[model samples]
Target: MDPSILSGMRGFGVATIPRWPWFVFLAGGMGCLACSSLSHLLACHSKDFNLFFWRLDYAGISLMIVCSFFAPIYYAFFCNPYSRLFYLASISLLGVLAIIALLAPSLSTPRFRPLRATLFLSMGFSGVIPAAHAVILYWGQPHIFVALGYELAMAILYATGAGFYVSRIPERWKPGAFDIAGQSHQIFHVFVVLGALAHSVATLVILDFRLRLPTCAD
Candidate 1:
């Protein structure tokens, strides 16, 4: 058992688990939202601004996907330092690669919308690896199972959002009716926000389970 894990355990009135993982996740979420808002707000300013802000928004999405791994991976592998480090490092590297791939201006074009969404969806779905591992690691724990359920929901929500993004639904059906409002892009953002909330609930559930454990040895 790691001494740090034991140290993080505390009695009432004190935090019972380390908070940095949650903070990392939250910061990533906020950064993504900010970039998204800026892209939507200023992309209309000019062609140059459009390209720049949209690219930043894509990069922010990658960052959030990477950071989303921290809380669950850290808590589930609390006493397994090597596994924790390996999973975290793997996701971080993948995120960097994703950002590098998206940096190509060619990928930002309308013709590549599906490609962009596919790249992001691939990054998001990669969570399945660590998620499956976590389930295997804590197979007997009901709370872990509950957390996994929420994670599954998050995955569905994100996939649905990506579908909306790539297919350009309702808006496509109505054409000019959705020009000013209710665009597919806007709907995609809403699903993303919902997905993030679902992920937050999963992380909190995992954190609570970890706190209740008397010791990492358990």
Candidate 2:
């Protein structure tokens, strides 16, 4: 469904909404999926392939996390460019640093799985500052709160997924029982997908709110 059409149906003003932020989120999502797909496909070919593709996968994950900040921050700060730039720049820097750390061969080892998980969680949590700011700015709007509820769900889902990824949940309990199926990594991936889906919903809700919410400049 086209967001513009949805907005029109919902009585959005006739002025064109800037869609570049939305597109940034979409591109990030597609890039993450594409990289993960390719990494899984090629990682088993050889040790070198495994190392390279896994690093790509990690970088892709970081990119997606960074991009997740764009639409929300862009729309939330639509009338406030300085704060917008600061938040975006901060997340971008963290994402780059995460990619570098995860790409390190030493850090890619099994022993560092917990560290990687912590890093990803930290990246997600970094949004807390900007999110609080947005709430302070838009707390009177019901839809903003509603959208934030969805984002909260997203955070929980992602956190649960990370927990599974790090603690090696069910498989950890039974080991070989889940060697081929119902594994921790597999479950982690599913949770991540669900989390992203929830995040997408939240992003759309925020976008819609921005289109409708009264501006302070008025």
Candidate 3:
């Protein structure tokens, strides 16, 4: 915590930071992974069911990505009220559009896999603008660099996953070789989980830094 805040707390303690953004992220993460696992497990039942569950999985992914934006954006722009509101509103609108497209049966099809991947990539990489802004605003803060390293790692992992998903890798190179193992889809899931872990670490770093400062001082 901020030395001033912590010292003040020593006499009259208070924890005033709102935690809704982080909580939303945790819920979204759980829902995304659960839906993905369930869809994979039950997709073999029938083609219709396969489509439905897969679409649900896509929706879950969208939810997680969108929710993940909240905490970072909130903490990053916390003191800059107008910027915070603008970023949040923009992402919320983009997320709505992304969810609508992902839930569409045609857009969710294998034939449109690249399109879906691009949409996700677009949403993810859009953070570049805000990250750049943050760096410019806090160039002397070492904690910002630490958090940025983790965020970059997340981006790489996620991009790798999207590549595997779009290319239908190892499986596509030798179809039957991966019949029971090493499917591109499985690899994609692995990378996504790894990416999320990286992001969570970054979030923790940022949270720790933010918690140490007075709320309106940044």
Per-model tally of clashing residue pairs: 0, 0, 2
Ranking by TM-score: 3, 2, 1
- The segments of candidate 3 whose C-alpha lies over 4 angstroms from its true place after superposition are 1-14
Write one digit per residue (lDDT tens) for candidate 1, span 72-182: 899988878889999999899989998987877888888999888888888888888888888898889999899989999999999899899999998879889999888
lDDT of residue 18 for candidate 2: 79
Q: Which ten residues in a row have the lowest lDDT in candidate 1?
A: 7-16
Error of 2 at 158 (Å): 0.3
Residue ranges of candidate 1 with Cα displaced over 4 Å: 1-16
lDDT (Cα, tens digit) per residue for candidate 2, span 1-218: 58666566554442445789888988998898899999989999999999899889888988889999999999888888899999999999999999999999888788889899999999999998998999998778887798789889999999999999998989889979998889998898898899889989988988878777554464
Ranking by lDDT: 2, 1, 3
Candidate with better TM-score, 1 vs 3: 3
User: lDDT (0-100) at residue 187 of candidate 3?
Assistant: 94
Model 2 residue 176 CA deviation (Å) reads 2.0
TM-score, model 2 to reference: 0.91
Cα error, candidate 2, residue 21 (Å): 1.1
